[model samples]
Target: MEHANDITLTVNGTRVSRRVPARQHLVDFLRDELGLTGSHIGCEHGVCGACTVRVNGEIVRGCLMLAVQADGCTVDTIEGLSDAKELEALQKAFHERNALQCGFCTPGMLMAALDLTKKNTKVTREEIRAHISGNYCRCTGYQAIVDAIEEVVNGQG
Candidate 1:
């Protein structure tokens, strides 16, 4: 067995320190070590965005990143997007518009949506589609998800 060592970093606004195996996936570190399961695991090969998380304020697939690589990085999962008091506007829009079907991909979808907003809130339909291309939803036929993103892109939410 490979021996692991301790590391410290900030996660979702909280200070955390722990020892993890060098080969451990960030997804496992977040979900198993830190107990933040919002970052789901679908296609572990990185084809699916289900394990997407923000690393140092940028979106990265957790399944594709090593925990040791994040030793000093700040990580934010879907759980970190909003406080318990209220939901993020995109979340509300998604919920109101029924953006999720099975919800296996909603976390990644939301992460991508948040990033898209940083570029510009007024995104074209095709742009929205392209932004979430990394994420795959098994349900909803995409119309509602697109509509929800449009609501946010159009600033209706």
Candidate 2:
């Protein structure tokens, strides 16, 4: 058996530590080990962005990263969207716009959207689509998602 390594990292503003197998995928470590199931596992090969999470302000597929690699990094998941009415603008906008369905890809999509918004406050529709190309929404066809992001980044929310 592979002996697990002790790992500690900050997640969603909380410090978390665990003994994980060397081969444990960061997705598993986050979801199963740490109970941060916001990072979903889809097409584990890194193609699908369903497992996306922000590490040090950059979107990274949890499935493609090792738990150990996040030793000293700060990670953010969909659960970090906001508290109460903090990100309410974006959350309410997304809900009203119907940006999600099935919700399997919601977390990753949000993380990517956050990245795009951070890249530039004036992000356009086409730009948002291109930014979230890695995240696939099997249900909604992406129109509402784009609208939600546009509304938020453009400060219409």
Candidate 3:
């Protein structure tokens, strides 16, 4: 039998309650239970930022956090940001700069970039790289991603 508990939380501004397995991580909970698939599972060890999401205003590795830990928190995934039109310019910048390929890491990269941009709109390419160093993208060589983020930071995106 699986060990599970019932919990309620706000996701993307919608309140929800569900039974989650004790061992189930937040990334799986979001993708499997809530059907929010934008957060990708990579590395599973938190070294990779593939499953990054904002929990109560801070970015966290979904793979490292348990669903129970998020019970009373407000979770924001890429879907929520997309639907909220919060990442429109950044998304457009990525598209225009061809910043994404294969797209496995795009969601996490976007989430990380979103956090970075929020902190300081005036950012340098090096700073951008440092901020997103946790995320790994096998394609695009990161130049495009950096350029895209820079464009957004400069209000040109």
Winner by TM-score:
3
The TM-scores, one per candidate, come to 0.93, 0.91, 0.96
**TM-score ranking, high to low:** 3, 1, 2
Output the lDDT of residue 140, model 1: 84
For residues 1-157, could you state the per-residue lDDT of candidate 3 as single tens digits? Answer: 9999998999999999999999999999999998999999989999989999999989999999999899999999999999999899899999999999999999999999988878765987899999999999998899999999989876764
Q: On a 0 to 100 scale, what is the lDDT of residue 80 in model 2?
A: 72
Q: Cα lDDT for residue 64, model 1?
A: 93
> Every model's Cα RMSD, please?
1.7, 1.8, 1.2
As for model 2, its CA RMSD to the true structure in angstroms is: 1.8
Candidate 1 minimal-lDDT segment of 10 residues? 80-89
Clashes of each: 0, 0, 0
lDDT of 2 by residue, 1-157 (tens): 7977888899888898888898998888888877878789999999989999878878899999999889989988777765423356667778999999798898788778877766665977888889999998999999999999999899775
Rank by lDDT (best first): 3, 1, 2
How many Å off is the CA of 74 in candidate 3?
A: 0.2
C-alpha lDDT of residue 20 in model 2: 83
Clashing pairs in 3: none
Clashing pairs in 1: none
Question: Which residue ranges in model 2 land beyond 4 Å of their true spot?
Answer: 84-86
